[model samples]
Target chain A: MRVRAQMSMLFHLDKCIGCHTCSVACKNLWTDRRGAEYMWWNNVETRPGTGYPTGWEDQDHYEGGWKPDGDGITLRLQGKGKALARLFFNPALPQLEDYYEPFTHRYEDLFDAPAGDVQPTAVPISMVTGEPMNVDGGPNWDDDLGGSDIFARNDVALDGVDQTIRAQMEEIERVVFNYLPRICNHCLNPACVAACPSGAIYKRGEDGVVLVDENQCRAWRMCVAACPYKKVYYNWSTGKSEKCILCFPRMETGQAPACAHSCVGRIRYMGVLLYDADRIPEAAAVSDAELVDAQLDMILDPNDPVVIAAAHEAGIGDDWLDAARRSPLWKFVKEWGLALPLHPEFRTLAMMFYIPPLSPLVASVERELYRLELPPERQDFELFDRLDKARLPIRYLANLFSVGDEQVIERVLRRMLAVRVYKRRQSVEGVVDDATKDLLASVDMTPEEAEAIYALTTLPTVDERFVLPPYHREMSIETLNDPLAHKGEVGVGYLEPPRRGW
Target chain B: MSDTVAMIVFVAFPYAALTLAIVVTVLRWKLAPFTVSSISSQLLESRKLFWGSIPFHWGIVLILLGHLATLFFPATVAWWNGVPIRLYALEITGLALALWAAAGLLVLLYRRLTTARIRAVTTPMDLVVLIVLAVQIASGIWMAVGYRFGSFWSVGVVVPYVWSLLKLSPRPELLQPFPFILQLHVVSFFVLVAIFPFTRLVHLITLPLPYLARPWQRVVRMRHIEPVG
Candidate 1:
């Protein structure tokens, strides 16, 4: 067996405070430099507003990545139709101005320019040029998504549809409007990975968190162009590109990721989820809806000795084992069907899972359907604005969280299944108590359903394997003194020294 | 006063310019936020820009290598070291690669110039760099044709004299024997260098790996709550 260890993350949208502490922490730690001014590896974009750099999702406008025309693929760019056409051809869609213009200060105005005009005591100037005036915005502008106009317009539910599933769609829209946090699904099959030409991007062997190689990144910004979600950022100064790293370094130490750790809402959950790497290709080949089967197969029993032994043998630590014992990843996934993959469509099997928001609209519609004694089959189903036609809109729900899963189209009138979005009520340190499952079962489901939910949500298998090589097997802060001890350097981590006088 | 002083400035100045270019390039590469940071949600989500940029850079790097080699080659290597067969092969191959690279550069340059966002970011300095590079490549090929070429001895003298000065030797004999055409080329090179630090040519100083490193963290943001925009 290839024996690939898989890892995943879950962000409770309800708990996210959007303080951007994570962004700043990331910036301070990594991207606080010249060319990187344009890049935000941990940027928190307000939806409904054209994200910074604007219309990033509209690939047709920018001409990035491959577009599947039925089954055939065509490059989205212009002019290179067949031959080496012209010396200068136009891109169908051009790159956008994602960052504000860099500004400088004017220091001369203080004592030199005006010359004895009361000689202003203090020179009010910008930083770059040091002149005596203020520069408008040189990158990192209006931090709060510019203003509230963008926020007021954040609700997509207001956009009424013309389809027969109008009422249900409206309901679905209402719930999403209430609160639906969307994140990188970290798909099991990331389209972004498939689209990269340089092979610079890869999903981690242990956690399955996809990453782009900075050294290999020729600043082509193709990843920027291809990701439908527009997650990647290009660094103009560094002559390369960047994106979110799921914080494997921190994870290795048994600490949650920066975002998860700093998340004030405490809605984030970090855990080791055992997945069958062998079944990935097979799962990726299945229809979007049937993808659930592939994901389910990857699930391992945490308590199983064979898996435990394998995990320990793989170099998993005690902290990780303990976390697995208490992880809600097991409870939500294997025990309950509530926690679901964001989007199964784009084919990137994202590791991030969401507890579908069952909107009041869905409840109301279900009640009405039950009252009428009519079977809610596909033929009679009202094509709700967001819900899937079958059980619910899992596919469409997936798109809300991922890039290309067409399964979202199959979902018809779906909405948020859980209320209290962005609230971090779940505990990462405590194991799920059986009494809670019994209580939930008594109120919401039959004994069998409750047990199934419990089984899915409880951490069944703990993977203690270290996907990191032996050199990384046991490391400490002291190891930094011996540069060679830092094994990441041998791999893609051997970053080029910064250019002189930088 | 000897013409050596002028020659010294002429030859020595371009290296300074090259240094400045190296600095800016390095700073841009090393300290830039995007290079060291994890992949941005914006970049990863866009598929097309990602791929288009790859070919664009390939064209750029190849062209740059060809240009660097042509501009800095030793005269002995150009003439006396006398591998007629190798020289002929190199010249032909280099010229072909240069042309291909130039074609790609033109495409990329055109993309930047025409794109609204890119154009906005592009300063006069950027345009100057492009124009200068274009001219250098064009003139290089023109001179490569073996007609009206600067003398090898002149190039040989000026290049070494300049190097000696950089090494703090300030040798005058290196410049005493060079031709006027070579002097003009040396002067032009200095002018290019004097302006290099102030332009985008500064990207050279950055070490390739750190300049290109990507973070592995995957991020998902709340719908309405973008990170303070």
Candidate 2:
């Protein structure tokens, strides 16, 4: 077993409250620069809405990620021969309009204007052109407009849902939505790495954080096309591609990434996960339906004795293993099987997993008196059975997460329901209902499991949410340079500011 | 016009170009490893580039490979040229490749000039390089056309002159008698070599040779030692 440790993240979707605090923190820390103004490295996208860069999940248009070719998977963009041939021009790249033109208010107009009946307002100016312009779009243009037909109706994830379900979702009174906060997944099988002709982008070995060596990036933008998540951004000013570095500088100092640290909903969980390095291709090569399970199978159990021995043999330290054992991601993803990777059919084997959101059941409208109807057969059933009646169809969640496997989404939603019911019973005055007990039993869950899930999801402290492994910077630095020589310096910065061109 | 100038141009200049190419390329690799890439503008304009790039790269690659073979393996070239049919075939193939390269370069030059996005990124050096390359190829085609039996003649004349330089013996006399265009082609070739390390031409050296054999995903650890698995 060629075991390797990958730093993984789990975002508990049920707990997310749709605040853009994480987005602001990430922007202020990283991408608030000349060419990167439009980039939100941690944008909170409202689900059932067209995402930033609009319709990024429309693979037919973007042609990002990997697809099975014969026996193995190849990049959806181009193969080696085609890559060399089209080395001069990539047709699939997104334009500035696709992602909105970054703009700032022209405050000088407000200050310099003469007094008149109409008040002088700050006009929006294009950051690129430095000219007065109307604000046509933004990074989060669809934020909280979940019921809008223009934004939410165009969501590609709903393509697989039945016409009835889609119609139901469009009902004005029954409109429901959830937040989907995204960052670079730092994938195990990153298509960006494979598509980079320059060999500039790479996944770090010490931790699995993927980074673009900006100096090496020739701005091919193949990484942009190859990434199904559309996380990679190109800096027009610097002439290089950039991406989420996963806050490695902060991580090395044992701090959570800015997005995770500043998250208002406390939905993000960070931790170490050990996996067999040799099985990456094997996992990615599986059929689309089997992709989620195959990827999960590749993540070795941290507490397994066999895995522990292999990890030790692979030179993983005790502290890292301990961190892995305490990982909330381990509980959510592997042990409980509650979380699923987004667009596993992309076949990049993304490291970030999300627990499918459980949108509340749509209330029936009757002569202006809205009421939730528990079906006659399910009247005796527990609240968990109401998952089938949720406003957001399980098929839509399945299409987003499980490559159209509704069973996986159903199981996760059921587990989430079980935990909520179990928690409600404990907090309220009533004893646990027999129907609730039967519901838990049907899903192969116990009261203890539900309680444990509740504690981690609802009541987790900061320490429990982010279990950071010790970053042995000294050991890593000694391999490439003298650690003592640079003892007092910060590890991650350029002495001079980066400029355009070579 | 004088012996000193001729010696510098023919002998001293070749050595200087070779040295500059090697030393500066090494320095750049050490100091600015990241900038050593082709800096492809593919994302900006693709349709016109698709037509302009493919033939240009293919034609140039064939021409370069043929040139390398003739330079390094004079005896093999001579043996092949001994037959009239083989000699005629080699001459035709070289001329065809040169013409193909010239055509491709013209398309590329047109695209570079006309495309707004490409023109924006086009530095003066980039234009100079393109013009110089076109001139070099045109001069080469001129020599091939004007001087019949150049495939056999160059084996005796240019090969020995190049070999003499590698052997550290100045033999400007061998090239001195050649036509001005042929001489200009040789001089411009060395000029390209001299400016190569400083330009995007440096990407030719960093062709990602290891990529073919490398695993799809690279797993680099801080430690050099292998795991005990």
Q: What value of lDDT does candidate 1 attain over all alpha carbons?
A: 0.47
Top model by DockQ, which number? 2
Q: Give, for candidate 1 chain A, the lowest lDDT window spanning 10 residues.
A: A416-425
lDDT of 1 by residue, A1-502 (tens): 2233446666544345456676676667666775565455655544333444454445556554444444333344321321122111223322324444333334444555655646555545522222345444422333334223443233232233233443343343332322333345555555555544334677765456777766545443445555555566665544455677766676655555666566545555666676655566666656645666567667776677776666665555444544555556765555443456644444445677655433222343363453222345422223333244322233333445433343432331121221111011124324444544443343444545544433333322223211221113344433344545544444664344543111
DockQ of 1: 0.06
Once model 2 is optimally superposed onto the true structure by TM-score, how far is the C-alpha of residue B88 displaced, in angstroms?
7.1
Total clashes in model 2, counting residue pairs 3 or more apart in sequence or in different chains: 5
lDDT of 2 by residue, A1-502 (tens): 8788888888888889988998999999998887788887788898899998899999888889999998999999988766655555677887777788788998988889999999999988877667677898998898888778999999999887888778777777767788999999999999899887777789888678899888677666788888999999887656688899999999988999999999888999998888888898899998887899899999999889999888888888778888899998888898899999989999999999999887777677789886667867664343466666878888889888999998899888888877777667667837887777887888889888988888888889999999998887776677766887768675568744466544
Which candidate should be chosen as best, given TM-score against the real structure?
A: 2
lDDT of each candidate versus the true structure: 0.47, 0.83
Model 2 misses residue B30 by how many Å?
1.2
**Candidate 2 lDDT over residue span B53-154, tens digit each:** 766777788988988899999899999999999999999998998887788889889988986656756777778778888988988899989988787888
